[model samples]
Target chain A: MKQFFIKNRISLSVLIAFLIFTGISFFADYQPGKAISKEYFFQFFKEMIFFLPIMFVLIGLGDVWINRDKVEKHIGKDSGLKGIILVMLLSMAQVGPLYGAFPVTYLLWKKGASVRNIFIYIGAFCTIKIPMLTFEIGFLGWKFSLLRTLVSIPAIIIIGIVMEKMVGKKDFTIKQP
Target chain B: MKLLIAFSVIAIVISFIADKRKTFSGIKSGMVMFFKLLPVIISVLIVVSIVLFLIPQEMIIKYLGEESGLTGYIFAAITGSVALIPGFIAYPMAGMLVKSGVGYSVIAVFITTLMMVGIFTLPIEIRFFGRKVSLLRNLFFFIAAILIGLFISLFYNL
Candidate 1:
């Protein structure tokens, strides 16, 4: 039981927090905080319900489908600028939370992707990619979409350069700490 | 009460399956992770709801309407930076902004940059990526955000 609790600390913490909040909410006055809390509770659950299946499938694919070695051959640091663009494209293709990109980025690092390229991947993951921007342009407008993409290009390059200078080539490795 | 009962039943069934499959570790750990995320999840919800309730669309339009000059620009960026909504939420919000005499350019800049740059997630990003990288990334993003805003403003102004 102790081991189980330790292992599931994240989940357990959430459960405890939820229960505590619920209890407090029940007794609390009808202030803005309480009202907002009540609304949030429902909204949080709704989003979680919507997001979970997608999260799980992505997790499963990470474990089974992706071939880190295969990706590395074409996009490793040794491949230079070409490598960076390829890796950036791959990162753009990926879905899920931006954090979900980290493990994959770490793996690519081990395979010898430059720190600069890793920065590109991270930047691109956050910025609008082709897949998502299409919907965004339709929903919003083309000029808006185009401007966003334009801004992102330079941002990605600048981030790539900055990351290289700050982190250097020392920290990135295949070995898990 | 209804959702609580439903969730509890699902949780119980999941736990039972884990017990039977002897995959208790993964299932148990997943739950624990869920529990840990509870605080942030709740806080975000609270903030979102408050924004939704307290910040009226009319107020935003009066201040941030297309013809409002630089104030409109700053307001759009501030609103975009602080607001945390899914793309779906943002899309309709943008549509409303356009219809309400708010600049399409402003809406575009706000929605695009909002999704890309996160003020709320900064601490988390710093914790995960370290201060150096986070600072650089965010600084770059801020510039990108402003540029995107300016470009849209110019484009639609024409």
Candidate 2:
């Protein structure tokens, strides 16, 4: 129990802070603050509950089914443009929150994906999700969507290259678990 | 949600058929990863909720609207970085802002930073990638977002 609390100290502290805020709001009769916080909490909670399980299961499946050599051969140091494109497509095809991308990126790193490719993947995952793009076009117009997409793709690639240089080649290797 | 259900079902079926032992072990490891990640996730969500509670919608619209000038662009970028609204909701909000006469550049900056920087998710990012890399990535993205906003504003006359 003590170990668990230690491990989750940050979460525990945040939860405590939230509870204190709620108490203060109730006592002070700040109904709007109280109501808004509660509403936001439940909304985020629902999203977490819905997505986290699926994300974990998919990560597990990838970990088991995909081997290091296969990943390295495809997206590793020597994989080059093909590997970058592959990562971009894979990320763009994904349908979930950005937080869900982190675990999968962790798995990819462990499997020996290059730092450049991983950064590209993260950028693409953030901006170019297919389902979201559909909504973007619908709401923001085709011109806006197309222009953003055009600019963002090259921007993401440039960021990836710059990050690779900044972080250096030595930091690319995964530390042993 | 539909996508989540579909993917989960597909993963379960594939895992069961491919190799039972591997599937079980994979799931076990995945759960371990999930638990390890839980603290950061919970903290980030709570922080985001508090931020959302404090920043009213009217304030956002007013500050990010057309007449607010350069300060509006900066405000949009900063707020977008901190706020954790999903893309689906952000689009409609952006549309409303546009309809309400907010500058396209401001909206562009807001959307770009919202996707790229993720101030609320910084802890989780730092946990995974270390402080230097995480901070640099966000810093770089912030600059890129501002540049993108400027380009959009210039090209489209917004």
Tell me how each candidate scores on DockQ against the true complex.
0.19, 0.58
Number of the top lDDT candidate: 2
User: For model 2, how big is the CA root-mean-square deviation?
Assistant: 2.4
Candidate 2, number of clashes: 0
For model 1, residues A1-177, the per-residue Cα lDDT tens digits are 585557446545755775676667677764654755566446655765555433433333333334667666676556677776786777666554443454455556655567788777877876755556766787767767777777667777777877677776676332221
Model 2 per-residue lDDT tens digits across residues B1-158: 79668868888788889898998888888777777777778778888887787886777777777447678878888988988998767899999998998877788889989888888898888767777888898998988888888888887874
Determine which window of 10 residues in candidate 1 chain A has minimal summed lDDT.
Answer: A56-65
Compared with the true structure, what per-residue lDDT tens digits does model 2 show for residues A62-94? Answer: 888888999999998899899989999999888
Model 2 misplaced stretches (Cα beyond 4 Å): A1-4, A20-30, A172-177, B66-69
Structural similarity of chain A in candidate 1, as TM-score: 0.68
* iRMSD per prediction, in order: 7.2, 2.2
Model 1 DockQ vs. reference: 0.19
lDDT of 1 by residue, B46-137 (tens): 44555765875566556666445666666777777666666666677677777777766576557655766666555445434666666666
Candidate 1, TM-score vs. the true structure? 0.69
